[model samples]
Target: MSKTLVLMRHGKSSWKDNLPDDERLLKKRAYKDIEHVASAFKHCLDKDFVFKSSYAERAESTAKHFLKQLGIPETHLHIESDLYTFDESSLKAFLYTVDDSLDNLMLFGHNPAFTNLANALGDQYFDNLPTSGLVMMHFKNSSWKDLASGKTILHLFPKNLR
Candidate 1:
């Protein structure tokens, strides 16, 4: 069976407040973008994927908004504190640890991790993965441990979606 991985960058976050980076919430435009992207992207997915989000407030909020817009249950979302990093190697290591039984894994977090990971593990090159951007890579390998390069099947950005 083929394995699929979807990497999503969190929506634009509010910087008006002096709050810590991890505590920052999504801006109004972010919510709009997330909704639009999620609604359009949801149609391309299969029902049995595992969804995970970084523990950061902005990322978690983005994940929740996406789930709401996609009509996916909140029960399907997992908050991973380790995913908050901006390093692609950390993200790749995390992917390697995912259960082999799960064929599809979706991650919501920050970048240049997402952008770098897409370039390292995908056939298509990405200059940047903007806020609310998503990239899906399909691999022939059944195990996440053996996941390396794969075909970039879907790449969606909020600006392009609109």
Candidate 2:
């Protein structure tokens, strides 16, 4: 079975200390970027995608916006706190727990880690996953456990769409 993975970085967050890290919401521009990327994904919604997002407000808000715009049911969405700042190994462990029934999966998380994880599973080198950037990758196998670098088919970012 073929598998598609959509990896997105969280939108820009308010840096004010008044709000906790987890409570920081997306900035206005970030929301705009999210909408742009979500609109792009709408063309591919027929792929039957499942979404997994970090529990942080920015990430969750980004995921919610995508769900709302893409008309994806909330039941197919998961909020995982573990994905907040995890490394490739941690992301691999999380992917291991995903149900095999899901064919196309989207992950909304933070940068550096998300960028690294995407690079680790696909032969793409992104200096940084900019705010609200989205990357789509295709793997030959059905299972996430078997994913590795050099298997990517496509990659895109919000700025690219601009």
Candidate 3:
């Protein structure tokens, strides 16, 4: 069975509050970016998809905004603390834990990990996955544990969309 994975980097965060890294809130521009991407991405969503996000405030907020823009209920979002890391290996390990029964998984989290994962699993090479960026890849494998190089079907970034 083929699998689809959509990786989204959290929106641009605000540093004005001098808050902890995980507590930083999103910038006003982030909302606009999320709205732009979500509107264009709605049609591409799988009928049955799981949307998960990191526990960080920015990531959680980004996921919520996407669901709101797409009209998906908040109950559909899952908060996974393990996704808060910046390491790609940790992200891959978390992916391996996802049940094989699901064909599509969408994740919203921090960068470096997301960018690294995309470069590793996708056919395309991206210098960086900008804030509010989303990439969709289709894997020909049946399980998340076996996920490998996949065809990068869509790559959306705020700057490009504007």
Q: Which one wins on TM-score?
A: 3
State each model's CA lDDT, in order. 0.92, 0.81, 0.95
lDDT: worst 10-residue window of model 3: 39-48
Could you tell me how far off, in angstroms, the CA of residue 83 lies in candidate 2 after the best superposition? 1.6
List the candidates ranked by lDDT, beginning with the highest: 3, 1, 2
Q: On residues 1-162, what C-alpha lDDT tens digit does candidate 2 reach at each position? A: 878888888888889768988889888888778888888767777787878899999999988887887777777888887888748778878877777778899999987778888888777777888888888888887787777653665555678776
Clashing pairs in 2: 123-150
The per-prediction tally of clashing pairs is 0, 1, 0
Alpha carbon lDDT at 68, candidate 1: 85
User: Is candidate 1 or 2 superior in lDDT?
Assistant: 1
Highest-scoring model, lDDT: 3
lDDT of candidate 1 over 36-152, digit per residue (tens): 888878677654889999999999999988988877889999999889999999999998899999998899999999999999999999999999999999999989989888999
Q: What is the per-residue lDDT of model 3 for residues 1-162, given as tens digits with 9 covering 90 to 100?
A: 999999999999999979999999999999999999998898886468899999999999999999999889999999999999999999999999999999999999988999999999999999999999999999999999999889999999999888
Model 3 alpha-carbon drift over 4 Å, by segment: none
